[model samples]
Target: MTKERIGHPPHPFDPARDPVHKRSKQGDSVGGAVVIVGGGYSGAMLAARLAERGVASALIDRGGDFGRGVAYATLFEGHLLNVRSARMSAVDGDPGHFVRWLETHRPDHADPDGFAPRRVFGDYVQHRLATVDAACPGLITRITGTVAAIGTDAVVLEDGRRLKARAVVLATGNPAPRTAPAGASERVIADPWAPGALERIGAEDDVLIIGTGLTMVDMLLMLEGRGWRGRATALSRRGLMPRAHGPRPDVPAPLEAGLLEGPLSGRLALARTVAGREGWRSLMETLRPLTADAWQAADPAIRGRIVRHLRPWWDVHRHRIAGSIAGALERLKADDRLTMTAGRVVAIRPGAASVSLDWTPRHGPARPALTADWLIDCSGPGHDPARDGLTGPLLASGRARMDALRLGLDLDDQGRVLDAEGRADDRLFVLGPPARAAFWETIAVPDIRKRIEAVAAALQ
Candidate 1:
């Protein structure tokens, strides 16, 4: 055994091509320990928690830093965490863990309520994993490769390497959005966070961004940070921007009485009732803690109704932006530098210098074709794993199946992956976004941290 750097491995290790394996007839095995695929926040926190309990685990991820993944791997200085530092802890029971770590590590921006740069958070995740690795030598194995398929007792890589383990966890984060419409300009960027995605845009070139969620906010900020002076148009079904976080009062009133007691008719009724009393923002906060249970208790038909009728409204209110970022957006709007429209793009015509988008307004007649120098897709990730190449194999072979809502992979209450036959696999577990179908609120750090802690305890 040789000592090597945990994260910055000398080179990518292909398990199938390991020369040392030739010395023995045994196939590649991680000693039958828990092997976590995807080293994002979910995987890193899971591995760290397991290590804390004296359990060694194997972590496998694709390119980039082990823990950053897509969200925190942003190189743009303007990309900030949507949540405050106080609530972004990677571990349960350690509420101030992330802020405390930042105090010693980066005192300049260590305020508990401050929203830190996303890359800083990424560094925090990597540091957490690194600390665990240091305390428990040889307890965490970092593998750099993608898992092509999952076997009953092992994971097979794309290169034909096998890692035998007692259990496997899929923490694979968000998948890239689907490809752009045909005949669209080559300048159309499906993944806004992709490296050099915004590099080719000129200072005065007009831009059109699809989707008006947090991802669109990120793109707007990135463009503004780069001193983009071109006109920008954001299109979505509702064209609603995320709300801004505000100063919390010293004391706040409890949620309105009977807000959650009565028979639920629909999201609109609930929203109007709550908003009439405590306001929509407060209503969201009040429901945030109970979202998982509320979602679980509701029948699939009710959930589907909410997803169809109230998702956009709930999304804008639920996922908010930093006050500063919201202020910048307002400034952009005030200066006529940005415009948001509620419509759906019907067709795209690409020209040599610009692309024309034909869209129909939500309630009005179809508008004239709008042209832009660049088009970006900020519609967020596709939720169907059965359609994704990486996770499709598992679904095709009955290792996993889509949930009723098709929002994410199906899993049991204990985070165990349910097979196509609807049987929980004791040896397989899932964490993070893929588990959203089972746990609607499983994507965020707070929700994922609890899930990771529970899964770690189960594995231990």
Candidate 2:
């Protein structure tokens, strides 16, 4: 068979004439005090928080079971948390719950400091759900179905049902697996979380993953779990692997009370403070509590500047991987089982059995071509309205609109949803990553836990 090549396709934009577009699938009326459209970390924590506040809440999940979102629902045994057990509790009220659980349950398990199996973490989240079930403080329900539409004050399910509520939370974790480059579909493994994503590999098969972040780590461990010995290549702009978290360093608070009130000069002052700190982990640990303040202090203009200059560096620095995962990656690099190439993808061609990829490596004169038996788009995509399959129609139809970053539903400072004219919707509320404009570092469990608490408090 002739080797087919592939590369960068195009930026996604299609509300009309797009094959993936669909209308709202309104379900039967199911009234919830607060209807959350996702079942991930953010949604689960918010549900419990709402119950604590004596509010009725219901969560609808596509996966059906309670605690398993795309990030947590992997059946693969080798997938582990990038964070340590101490930082991984599903609930913010009990910071050490995960660590305590590990000690009580899997004390004998190896590498407790390293990444723990994602299954155990998922189980802990499930257990939290079970606890909420027993309490019955306020109405919090879970439905197993897809989300079809999100109205101004209601959530519509795929089965043509709607849950009109005072608030709606879009806690859908990560976006769907990206569509591969044109002609790359034959060898594309679009969804990493899908069943048999790694199992499709043969012992001698070569694999190419689009990014070298946590998902790549998951893929590595999954293959290692299956005893599949193969060559894998990861490509990205920097090709920089996530930093492994070592012993928690003693990072002092970097900013004072006025540090958050930023206008470029103040930000420089904070940058100087960070400069004094030892490393990225120390910088983040100090900035954790102060993040919301800093985020709110900067106007959208500064935020955009940061996105352009600092976001990529911040991601690698802040989102450090587990020590064990990093160690394994180091070993793989040493053994040449795993390889990472730094560059932008130029093209791809999917053949019957293998996909050919063309990449420009770090401004190097020569663009290289490599073939892999399978390719997974680990380059994380945003949970755009279209990908979520619920809010997209509303946005295109002028019922709603995207924020500056085109992430989640747009909202005002007080957490009120914004309509197409950039006006706040009185009866609607948004939470989690969709509210990222209000809270920059909100994707983490610790951050989400705190946000959920505030969301609950605000609702009361």
Candidate 3:
């Protein structure tokens, strides 16, 4: 295959004009189609990119919509994106693609620096996919179903359908939030993003949210929008809420060459010194582009130390909330309507009317038991690959292996999955959060878009 043909595959291999067989017969040869599991932004964007390049792909998702994953599926107007519009482009080379889309579709809210509602961004993603699909008709097939497992050269669906493909990309995005030890109960809302879960709470319900990160912020916004007059308490180990966004700082000067190579602790000390001079936010902004490189360079022991000691602080400062949302949260705190507690729930007793929780503070002894009319677990997405329904089976079957730190599926530099014996699979790949083990900064749109470009360029 020539360099030019890498993107624009020969017409004979075009699955668009000629669809791949639904199922492979015994002893059948490999097909030309690519199957992408997970219809979230990553998967959808990958399909669009492949389609534009004259390759054929099947995008499978359990959700009804193609691009509106859990993060963007919110209908609440208060669900604004954490990142500014100028930086949230879905196109790799075009940083202002999203802002341009906003100017055309929503002229009233076209400020490049302003945060747009996530739902609108979801619409923008779907629109882009539609445009690509129209341009390359039949190149991208949309399948609405859950993937049961991945075979050697095929994607098996939960409904018993099999799609034979030359390559399969796992873009399953973030897994569902981990359930609490209390188990399932009507009074406990395990996953706040679940359809109609928040709506079930009455306006007078006293709520206990077990997280203080972005997901916790989301829960607060949802409650405030519903005019819930009752008090709410958010608990976490460190009580570290995400900081609010502000004016973008100018890019800082490069770090010293010596600062970039050292133990994680030494690097962190360097970060502290820089933050003392330039401020923490500026340091975080400066570190954004360099995080993945630094992470990939670190040894597993260093990575483990970072995860155990610095992850929470890194998350709050790195992934900030919208300024408007921050102000609203502050107002609630000032009014004594919302409380942020640093603690862990030691025990949960479910009663007919309410749930009682015994929480132990970070620095103090166990506090008195508190009762809540409803309990919501917004502790964020689960991280264990072995716990994942679709990918778990692959790991058990020795088809895939977890990363050294168990942060995500083990993947090579090229996004190919590493098998149980530490071999990269040429025909299988992982993307987005599932591949976070290899690329620490793979979750954001800009990062994932660039990844799609690389993967598409490398496709055989």
Off by over 4 Å in 1: 1-29, 179-185, 249-253, 266-271
User: Residue by residue across 1-460, what tens digits does model 3's lDDT show?
Assistant: 3222243324342334434222222232224578889899999989887776667788888976999888889999899998888899887766767787787778766899898999999999998888777756677888899888788988888899988988999888887577465356788887788889888788888998888888888888888898888888888889989998876634664565555786767778888888888778778777888788788888899889888889999999888887899999999899998898898778777788898888888987668987899988888777788977777888998889998898889988889988899998988898888888898888778778878887776653
Off by over 4 Å in 2: 1-32, 103-115, 179-184, 248-250, 253-277, 386-388, 397-399
Cα lDDT tens digits for candidate 1, 281-341: 6777777777887777777887898789777877787788889899999999999988999
What TM-score would every model get versus the actual structure?
0.89, 0.84, 0.91
lDDT of 2 by residue, 1-460 (tens): 1011012222121112223222211222246467887887778767765654456678888877677677778887667776766677665555566666566557754344556777777877876666655554335688888887777677777798877876676677767556465334757877777766666688778899888877777788888878878889999888877887866533555545544554666665676666576554666676667767666766678878777767776788678876767788899889998998899888877888788888888866876597888888888755556545666676777766776765467666666667799887656566666677657777777777777766766665
Best by lDDT: 3
Candidate 2 lDDT = 0.69
- Between candidates 1 and 3, name the one with more favorable lDDT: 3
TM-score for candidate 1: 0.89
**RMSD after CA superposition, every candidate:** 7.0, 11.9, 5.6
Tally clashes: model 2: 14
